[model samples]
Target: MTVVELEVTKSADELAKTYIVKGILSEKKEDDALHVAIATCAEMDALVTWNFKHLANLRKAELFYSASLEKGYLKKLEIVTPMEVSNYES
Candidate 1:
């Protein structure tokens, strides 16, 4: 990747870590948080995960969405499991 690409990636990484440090993600689930953070930062409409204990739970989803909105992530995010999506598609 070009220097600019590398820099952008670094910035996104920092932002993901910031979410954890700021308590947006409980218990420092860095990898799981990173996945959600990426989707949030990218302005995706949904994050489909099997991580019901964290990323896919109602409480955690609410927290993530609220914190993201407060931090200027305008697009509201939906957290769902892959099964949820597949069922919807079916």
Candidate 2:
């Protein structure tokens, strides 16, 4: 798997920081980790993970879909567990 850093502009960083401070955005480690995956999926094709608690959970999936729609970021992105993708081939 390739790891890439997503660079945000100073203004964007400030906005994100403000969101965190306002309590509208989550600052939990799990949430932050999933956010990174979401960012990757938004910019790339897919995001593979085993983080069921944060990223691969069905409830979180629904939330992600809704959030993407609300943000006008409904793109062709897949967030799946490794087993889910592996099972598809079998």
Candidate 3:
């Protein structure tokens, strides 16, 4: 298994802050925002997670996608579960 390099940039932090400020993610969930922001800024293909309420919901996905685009990230980063990715690989 290849270990993905964690990319944490200033832009990523800003993106996370933006989400919180816009109420896309609650203040209590800044860490969750950071996870998505890092994945987005790193240009990862997807963010694999089990946290449905804060990290793996479709409504949040749409909002994150738009926020990322607004921040000039052109790539569409998918938020999914490990099982979902495994199935996709087949």
Candidate 4:
């Protein structure tokens, strides 16, 4: 895996806010939304996380993807755990 130097960009911030506005994420979970937003804006193919409660589940994935699409992030981002990628099958 290559190092990806990512930051909290303006577009990411706005997208994160959209997640909050849509009630997909709470403000207290701002960090979670920001993480997703950043990866979405960075055009990442996937974002590996162990936080299954918020970031690495199917229900949350649908919500996050919908919110991202609303913000013009057309590409789908896979939010998965390390194990998922390690054992991925296509």
Best-to-worst ranking by lDDT: 4, 3, 1, 2
**Higher-TM-score candidate of 1 and 4:** 4
- Alpha-carbon TM-score of each model against the true structure: 0.72, 0.54, 0.89, 0.92
- Candidate 1 RMSD to the correct structure: 6.0
lDDT of 4 by residue, 1-90 (tens): 665889999999999999999999899999999999999999999999999999999999999998888778899999999888765545
| Location of the lowest summed lDDT over 10 successive residues in candidate 3 | 81-90
TM-score, predicted candidate 1 vs. hidden true structure = 0.72
Model 4 worst lDDT run, 10 consecutive residues: 81-90
Error of 4 at 71 (Å): 1.4
Off by over 4 Å in 1: 1-11, 26-28, 86-90
In candidate 3 the C-alpha lDDT for residue 54 amounts to 84
**Alpha-carbon RMSD, each predicted model:** 6.0, 5.1, 2.2, 3.0
Best by TM-score: 4
On residues 18-46, what C-alpha lDDT tens digit does candidate 3 reach at each position?
A: 99988899999999999999999988889
Q: Give the local distance difference test score of model 4.
A: 0.92
TM-score of 3: 0.89
Q: Model 1 over residues 1-90: C-alpha lDDT tens digits? A: 111111235545665676687786754688777777777777666877788887888888888777677667778779998777753422
What is the lDDT for 5 in model 2? 65
lDDT of 2: 0.53
lDDT of 4 at 89: 42
Once fitted onto the true fold, the runs of candidate 4 whose alpha carbons sit more than 4 angstroms away are: 87-90
- Report how far residue 77 has shifted in candidate 1, in Å: 1.3
